[model samples]
Target: MTAPLTDDEVGKTVVDAEGKELGIVAKVNGSRAYVDPNPSLTEQFMASLGWEGDDEEDYIVTEDMLESVGEEIVLRGEI
Candidate 1:
């Protein structure tokens, strides 16, 4: 069954099992979370150099990663 989306789940901090910052919950669409993944070194460098191209690279975190759905989305691990 699909888990219910908590009120605070969206727009909250998502952390790994060991409390590493993965990313933020950009939007919760249906049962999916459109997570904008942490930028790569190249992307960061390009941004630093004033590149404004859109980077449509993001990951979808599903119910499988939710160890808990409160305060923060505590993931099972690095997923």
Candidate 2:
């Protein structure tokens, strides 16, 4: 079986099934990982790719959706 990821590896890039740039793992809250759609995008940009909140907001992604953790994080589906 695959090993589980640790907190240190949580804030990695979350890619899509096709290896597309989806978002970056912001933080792990409980059983969910908050994903920041575009890590480089500033809050004032107001782009649709980002999470539905300000820079201080956290987007909750379930642990089950997490695919892998390495140089980049991978998710099961689009964020």
13: Cα error in model 1, Å: 0.5
Best by TM-score: 1
lDDT of residue 15 for candidate 1: 82
Can you write out model 2's per-residue Cα lDDT over 1-79, one digit (the tens) per residue?
1235445544467677689976766655456666677565553233233333325644666767766667876677543
Query: Candidate 2: deviation at residue 47, Å?
Result: 20
**C-alpha lDDT values of all predictions:** 0.62, 0.58
Q: Which pairs clash (backbone N, Cα, C closer than 3 Å) in model 2? A: none
Error of 1 at 30 (Å): 1.5
lDDT of 1 by residue, 1-79 (tens): 3366543354566788998888666556566665546755664454345342333676778876677777677778645
The lowest-lDDT stretch of 10 consecutive residues in candidate 1 is 46-55
Error of 2 at 9 (Å): 2.8
